[model samples]
Target chain A: MPIQAITPDYHGEVRDRLENFHGNQLVYVGWDRHLLFCSAVAFPLAPDTRFAQLRDEAMAGVFGLHPEWAQVDWGRVSWLLDGEPFEPMLDRPLNEQGIGHKSLLRMQTPDLKGFQSAGV
Target chain B: MAAKKLNIKDKYRLLTRDLDWEFSYQDRKEAFPYEEFEGIKITDWSKWEDPFRLTMDAYWKYQAEKEKKLYAIFDAFAQNNGHLNISDPRYANALKIFLTGVSPLEYQAFQGFAHTGRQFGGVGARIACQMQSIDELRHVQTQIHAMSHYNKFFDGFQDWSHMHDRVWYLSVPKSFFDDARSAGPFEYLVAISFSFEYVLTNLLFVPFMSGAAYNGDMATVTFGFSAQSDEARHMTLGLEVIKFLLEQHEDNVPIVQKWIDKWFWRGTRLLSIVAMMMDYMLPNKVMSWKEAWEVYFEEAGGSLFKDLARYGIRMPKYAETTEKEKEHVSHQAWWIFYNYGQAAGFHTWIPTDKELDWLSEKYPETFDKYYRPRWELARQMEAEGKRFYNPGLPQLCNCCQIPMGFTEMDDPTQIAYRQTVYNGERYHFCSDGCHDIFVDEPEKYVQSWLPVHQIFQGNCGGPGVEDVLRDYYRMNVGADNLDIKGSPDEQRWNAWKGVA
Candidate 1:
């Protein structure tokens, strides 16, 4: 996937330097493959939020991304970068992990195959 | 008394063509500067034929007659207390949605068409737009005048002009027309006159008008009929523009094709609201959105595209997905409104027992399997006095500006999510179709006035929902809300029926 390839060495480099970072990031939090309503949810994140907090808020519509009937195991929920999974340091603030603003994330079932090559 | 009469066709030809002269005082390039930048070639402007052969005199006479008839009905409806004759108080919510979401679009079309009427390079095309501009103005006026009877007793109708500009849900229609309005003249014609009017007019007009008729809304039905008569001419203009452009030059084909692709997808996304209004909002429904889609789009539009195929035109890229979406869009859209109706100017409610049964019957495959359970949960919550509402703002799609609530294709359990990065900032779309539009014109869409984002940025009056709704959106609490048992209109309706 494009995201994983762009950040293959993500853990060693950005993850190490993330503790001091403080900036906002916009993200998409989605679950399930069948989009009964729309494709995904979008939220602009605050600098102080931990991944756990962000995850909880997404579930509760804090960032305004409420999908009815969506259920995800909060702990197991992974953030997708370019449709590929990234192991987010859940306890850490997003900026601490160098996940800067405008980051795209999808919290889907871990084993679901990503990105079908559908023609537009 | 015995004077020879001129043939009507010959007279039309003489009046339309013989009147135009080469610009003597003004430079042609300076006068019509906007049309050619999109690279659409039109070597011979005279090749543009208005099949309807409409001229100002005929248009004035026809439209004036229609207006006279429509207003006479409007007057009678009001004088006879026609609001009391509607199917239900809930039925006014459908008109509320229409007035709040759609009538402003007619006004916007008036402006867009007025621009093309002034700016297009061809006299025939310009005249067509000028006529359509007046028609659109008439539509907005008649729709408002017709709804004025309801507005006298209803809540949502009073604030549409202002609400359409600032309300979150209304941003969907506003933004779509704004996107079209921002384009060059040729693109505007293709976006609205061609794609919207010709290809998708039936889906928008038929259900609402038919529902109006079914619901004993004579005023709306009358206005709808009058507007529809004008729509026939608009549709002809749309068809003629496509053919005229295609036949102009070989190089124009690809440009027109791209425009067709962009606009067809845009138009479909905008019409999703209408789908919900048809299927769910109207208490006395005329037809399901899926059935309407099958008849108007898949069947009729399919044949029209086949004819256009000879000219190297094809259907929109996301035609298959759009077809798939018909089964679910109305359901999903209504669910969103049901959950978030409090924040809106119009009221929304869960479908009644008979209405739910109608949905189940209409959507045999997906309704029970996918939507019914969630609605059941909502029903349970309401029974327990919880009455669910999305307590927070919804994440709107970057393209359509609608809440991100659609499910994946053939998979109602999951969200259909797509994203693309441009200039290091990631943009999110609710579908591949919307994503494709963004990629094609990232510069244009990236600047979208996304309502949810604007709210978060403190640009929407203030940081809180109260300020946003009252100060910015101007939504009056009990009146323009979905407390079904508590609405003033509902109480008024009850008193009118002697139930209060």
Candidate 2:
């Protein structure tokens, strides 16, 4: 027998709740364990800005801690979604790279020299 | 280029209902490969309620706002030297447990939802899983951000991702998530979303958040409050999934029951860490672990199961024994951590005099009669400058990966042990609940990365203790573990108070 998944009737309070969702998600930028920046800025699902640009933006306000991060050669650092690196420049808009709301752009220096050429 | 005017109901319908397409180009089974074989019978795809009915636009908008507020609080707390503002240095261990044991599980749940979001036949269920996938990832980031301030001031907060993988005690949670992740999607939902989230999450999250408030860890309280609202929706999803499964077909009831039985035991074992953290680790107690369990699990959960009785679901197997264990499990787990602190990343100390008096008051049934005398001897040993460390590795339960420190139900003095032979190798469990899980799925469990066995096999750094703790676990002795008299954190706390 074929499987059939049924969606329940949506009216009344369920419909109302569905219509007005209160839990909106944020885009997070991080270096190691620190959350450098999380913004209400809703870049399009397919963003025009490059991942390299986002890294610079992460260092924008918190000059106290972020200047050191700037000196650390972020080009050598790989942008990660679970733990694996994705080349966000090639994938231009983050949506093209499977990056979405609540997705973490973890910065790690996996292979210092290898990442430099990968970005190039 | 203009803001589109769309009704919420119409947008939800467009996103969920209109998006689904029947597979005409390939076999449906080939397209969504893993949903079956777990024996859950879903007859009508429409019966599944997408409880949140959340669209990407709304999801991103609302969650972004909440996270912006949360990060602002994180910044304010960090700028003000919030670590120094905490009630006691010892209270940081609660956050340590959160980072090590709990945060990684959210990442695991993130992966689980990602898999289910793709695999489920129902569009509504798929959308829900997709949204929760994002929620779990946000939890991992927010929590790490919230606790990152302590990494500057405290030891044991560093190298947690490494420690979570290699440490002996940390294996318990790692192995639990591994168990859930390895299963089929429906079983994963049953194991985590229902059993862990619906039934037992309160026991883990609420008291710790309350403990954070009482202890003045504002960063934790902020993150906890942020996560709590999301958890309410997740809890509803859990209930909705279970009811949908049971109502879809009569055949699903027994399958659902078996999952409930297995996962409830699995999830309860996982919560032993929370129990100990509540009863012993919190410097300013919110309530005893027993009170929290009674209020959260027995009172609330009992009523939840009673409501589901009409669907042929009963409370989990071994419910009575689990209730009886409330008085004892926290002490046993904490005793293990206290004695074995050298092996762990966090500091552990015997309760102070006032704290012991509090334990005695809270646990009038079991503390003085059974646990206090052991502490008295430990105190004597500490006094004589013979600080006890277990020189030998402990025998770990094959299933739960907790040490065989749990006591017998009737005797309370004798250790509880259950063993089964599968393929000529004897495996032991700390309780019948674990033993039952192993027997039911021997093929799945026999391959468990039992940390003790790995040590004997020389997979963990090297044969020496120093090599394991230093090279493999990446933990420093004087800084990362309990010195009782003073570690850097302790010295800082004292120095801040003008103590010489």
Candidate 3:
């Protein structure tokens, strides 16, 4: 239902518009079933940043702290962009792959459950 | 002729309802401009019963007497060094959360009630709201006085009002009140007084007050006792407001129900911090968060909805979801805080072995299988000098402003991620309840001043996390935040106790 207001023309100004960020769009990445990290990590990234750079540089600093990080096989990892399954072009920029501002990318690693399969 | 003596009810009527004048020259609608904006039809103002009959003079006398007793105890608690008598220094962290996050809410309640009091056309409601507004003002004052004894010896208490405006985690409580205050008058009553005070208040107060009693904090327990009668009156007023609206016009039922659903969900999300406090922060434990939910919410609220069924009001929409979530929210919330302790205002730590066992026994269904392993790993890492802190910011729910840490009830392994696009911009929620609220009022929620989003946008002090924490948030680095193991709070307590 639309909001009931004194003025019929009530429209909210979007606070997190892409233009508000200085040359960066917000991207949220979560590793499926990994409760150890608590929640998805939100990053402000330039749209031209490559998918591989996000993996090897930014994600490594976060997911690497887990004891099971070393055993994960990257080749078997699957991805979901905004809840739809997608395969990212590793060397291509995120904007070219339809990843826009405030996009959620979830990564799932096969056969490597969280910390003894206890969802840790 | 002998003058006749008047009784309390007659005096209350003469003083309150008799003062309102007829709108002969002015338009009635113009006087109460916001009454019909939200589609509520109030057929008769006379049907609005006054919930309480205390006159303003009597109210001041009673409150002044209570203040005399309350301040004497606060003096005694301070003179005796009550800070040293707590079960553990860790218990003080809960007080920090209360002073910063909860006390300021009382002030906001004062503002809300005062504003809404003038907007209602019914003289009874205006008088009741005026009394409650005064009660709220007293509450915030007494709460501050009660916690000031701890401030002399605590780190996090110093910059609470500052942090509430700027900090990441404190935004959860801040935004909840901001949302309620900015809403229409009737909706504010349904949200704060009915849904929060009437339905969900015990879940908040019982935990804190009982936890204080158990943990040897007399000041807080006394404050709780002093506020008990006011809360009772507020709860009755809440019930009266709902019944008056529902009986006046049938059209009002659906609007009230929608507000109940939205507020109940918002209240449950806001109470996650309290859940963490009950389950983890209190050094001498009260009941577990799950047990408290069962007793206060399920048992008590089950009967409330049953009573309200006569007026076409059912249980809140996501109450079943909240029932399942009670088992996991405390653990999940604590994990989020522990992971981001570096950025928080209060200290966080892994539960001791005994507390862990208590949690396992309280939540036998999920604790051992899911949460225990994570804490065990944290303990192992702490032993190796690798205490874990997430080096990245968390995605916050666009409505609740809490990090999206809640997991699916059925799965508990997968994060419950719900998203919808409004006007080409995507918004995410931690659960269906928050998602529904956002979907209903996208225009209202899209303007949320999310702390993390603001930080990323460089609207906060600086680009770096440390810069924001130190300069913008005003937290004392290495003093107010991080794990409590070797912090100044722990060291000071150990020194005072002569522990080597």
Identify the candidate with maximal TM-score: 3
TM-score per prediction, in order, is 0.89, 0.80, 0.99
Over B122-170, each residue of candidate 1 has an lDDT whose tens digit, in order, gives 7777777888898899899999999999988888888899999988889
C-alpha positional error of residue B13 in candidate 2 after TM-score superposition, expressed in Å: 0.6
Mind giving the per-residue lDDT tens digits that candidate 1 earns over A9-119? 322112111121233445555545423223344456676679778766664553222222344345655567657768887799877875665555665555433222111
Residue B246 lDDT in model 1?
94
Mind giving the per-residue lDDT tens digits that candidate 3 earns over B1-500? 75597787787778889979999899988999988888899989989888977888889999999999999999999999999999999999999999989999999999999999999999999999999999999999999999999999978999778888888988999999999998889999999899999999999999999999999999999999999999999999999999999999999999999999999999999999999999999999889999999999999999999999999999999899988999999999999999999998889999999999999999999999999999988888899999999998999999999999999999999999999999999999999999999999899999999998999889997879999989999999889999999999999999999998
Model 2 TM-score on chain A: 0.48
Which candidate comes out best when scored by DockQ? 3
Using lDDT, rank the candidates from best to worst.
Answer: 3, 1, 2
Share of reference contacts kept by candidate 3: 0.83
| DockQ for all models | 0.15, 0.01, 0.84
Model 3 has an lDDT value of: 0.93
* CA RMSD of each candidate after superposition: 6.8, 20.9, 1.1
Which ten residues in a row are the worst by lDDT in model 3 chain B?
B1-10
Which residue runs does candidate 1 get wrong by more than 4 Å?
Answer: A1-25, A31-44, A56-82, A108-120, B1-14
Tens-place lDDT digits, model 2, residues B130-157:
8899999999999999999999988889
Off by over 4 Å in 2: A1-120, B1-3
lDDT of each: 0.78, 0.75, 0.93
Task: Please report how far candidate 2 places residue B401 from its true position, in Å.
Answer: 0.4
